[model samples]
Target: MSNEPVGVLVIGAGASGAAFAWSIAGAGMSVLCLDQGPWMKQRDYPSNGLDWEERGLGEFATSPNVRGLPADYPVNEQDSDISPLMFNAVGGSTILWAAHFPRLTPKDFRMKSDDGVGADWPIDYQTLEPYFALNDRMMGVSGLSGDPAYPYHEPPLPPLPLGKSGNTLAAGFEKLGWHWWPSDSAILSREYEGREACINLGPCLTGCAQGAKASTDITYWPVAQRKGVKVRSGCRVREITVREDGMADGVLYYDEEGQLQEQKAEIVVLACNGIGTPRLLLNSKSQQHPDGLANSSGLVGKNLMFHPYAMITGIFEEPLHGRRGPVGCSFWSHEFYQTDRSRGFVRGYSFEAIRGLGPAQTALQGMVQGFIPWGEDHHRAFARLYDHTATLLGITEDLPEDTNTVTLDPELKDSHGIPAPKVTYRLSENSRKMLAHAVERATEVLTAAGAVETVAEPLMRGAGWHLMGTARMGRDPKASVVNERGQAHDVKNLFIVDGSVFVTAGGVNPTSTIQAFALYVADSIKKNIETLFDDA
Candidate 1:
């Protein structure tokens, strides 16, 4: 086999990896991105057909913990209530994401200082603000600027429409004197950059057939590839090899044909989110780093966090026309986002306006949620829940704990004979209290909007989307896996550009901040490529 040295080797072509690679493709450095899954075509997305909901629950489901495809490595989630959801393909989970793009508040970065609950990020929000704008333009975000919930920053496109469901919820919030705004979305509001406007096909979580959703495969990858960034799909990296000088040299991976191959690189960057990043590091054990590379702090697989979610749905007498627009939540309220001493929880949660479910989901949910009966009354119950339901989801801020961790399963291995990631998580007391408060408030809103009946579920199944904080960033090498620049504290040439390095898990969606950090770290790498080994 021919072996050649690569200038930069980025593992995992997800949100962070794609953003970083795209930013540095023109900086006179050869970059190669290796993904474990295949490069999927937009035409082959599940939303192209009538069986979209079935496809979403089956192959295109957000969770690798659920989707169990050949390309997906099984995650052992028997110990956790919230199962980890991730897509192994080129665009990562964005292929199945709802495209809700919300930035972390400035206080999210200074969690330790502001609330004294979790660790503070090595970098601040102001440091990432400009890159947030850069990524917004690249991904084509849609939102209204200058909401009192956050600091002022102009959006690239106008806000996505607030359908009848959103309007109804807004009226309730207005009556209650609470904060609410049209959510920032990765979906296009109008035609831009050769991409078509959203056709509002509903069920955007499965996929977007109109090419309106800004998955990196349709956004950054196209431009990055054109600028000479080489992407190798169907390649699962097994380990990062170390050179004689105790620096990262390259990676060993299993190719499509299941053959072991070694690809050398001067710099090795990991964008494999939280779980995958820790798993790879723990598996890559060597004599110089016997406990796992860059793991001298013993925090590689520690502090695993997933934003605990709660769902509350209301049954209305009138249909809200939820089937006519994007399937994801249309509006959000950050009124309860900050910490308040009287709230009984340190960090707060955000509420989103979720649309009604599809026919199959509606029937299943009705049966499960218990207002709809079985056997004789099933049809009548289903009719009541069909298009007359509105939902609100509360994404709670989960604090980091050493007990909530990702470890290697001793017995389970994947199709490639690699050890599987075992997630062990439990809801904290603070999180439980937050969920209760969110459910109560959501029920009040729905009741204010004239809901005949309401159902609330504090902990929803299959809601773990943002996996973060396994390899945290800090100023001290002994306490953190990476530094402010996402550089591994122990390994000089090894870097991470994903949510794994996040110090805290914010209440809102993390994709926007994940991309912003990727851009910031990419600029840092480009500026410090000559001095990358100076105690990073």
Candidate 2:
């Protein structure tokens, strides 16, 4: 074992980990970032016109972490339907995210106080606001100012070009007398921070070839590396090593070739996404802490929440020119972001009016939706939907529930011989109601916007993209795994800075908020290093 001690050991190179590493390294900490995936470059991204299967390169059926582990999303052999989607790469999920960077509203933090649901966050929106601004600037978010929905923050850069779909949505909002604003996106409209502007490539999901979409590889990770943070890719951290005194010392992981290795550190920060962090803790069973490293509270893997979502598509008579911009370019009304007394649901949803269907995606979508699996009808349906289809994707807030959890499947181990993180999530009744309400409103909005045909795909239980609240941060140590500053309650030198700390799933994409919270936690760690080490 090497005696070299890192000031901070950051696990996972996703949005939170990258931001945390950057902030700490900028503060002159010796940071070592370990990612369970390999680094991918712009050249590795597929060409704009490639088919979906061909374009999903870095995101293929190969497990980047454990060699023979099944892909995150497996294709059902009989039904041929794709399962859950997750990207394994240096940039993590940010490589395939839509880049819709919306700030969490004040109500999101005080959900317990304002509404009778969920736990209140120890920190409020005001405390996190500055960090949000800093994260926005770091990520090069482009947007206009004056969203009455959220507290004021200076716009990082000018808004991206409003394409045909955005324009139509804007018109519909105007007609309905509802407030609408340009969706804040992490894509560069103009070259900012030396990165290039978006060349209007429509597909932002399959990794941004132009370096415009703010993946961590282009944003924080590079800055962190330049600032002396050592990033080691293809290192799958399986367990957090804890001292007898209940302090995190380092981690045990596997190298690219499945060789087991251990790294020591003064402080261990788990910025691995919600699923990975809990799994690491559960795997790290020591004599002092039998359940997990930070499982004294027994809350490390409980209270899982993912924003229940619904997709409502509108088929217009005229071609909407959907393929001219990024998929997450537009916004719908956030008028229902807060809890409405009239609605049975406890929280609300944000409607994002977006353009869909790159030529290949459109063809696949048409086939799945029963427009003839092949032949001329498929081709015609593809062309029509490619140009005429617009969608309103509703990101509804999902209440945290202990039942929806990430637990270790005792029977299922990965290729690394470590048990895989098993997600057992079921949507709450409130979430179901919210999704139903969102679908209805979305259909109304599409119809009002002059859609000749509309189709609504309401998400069932367990169908959500926004993962959060596993190792939640709160005032009560007994009730949460981490404290307000994301410090683990059980392990003095351990921290969890990610969506897992979120108490509630706010009605927005969580990337921006996750990054902001990571930066905030990094600052907290820097300011309280003496206390953290001395107490340990």
Question: Considering every candidate listed, which one attains the maximal TM-score?
Answer: 1
Model 1 agreement with the true structure over 401-436: per-residue lDDT tens digits:
999999999988899999989999999999999999
lDDT of each model, Cα atoms only? Answer: 0.89, 0.79
Q: Each candidate's TM vs. the true structure?
A: 0.98, 0.94
- Residues 273-390 of candidate 2 have per-residue lDDT tens digits of 7777788889899988899878888888888777777888888888888877888867756877888979987879998878766666666667766653676576666666768888
Q: Write down the worst ten-residue block by lDDT for model 1.
A: 1-10
TM-score of 1: 0.98
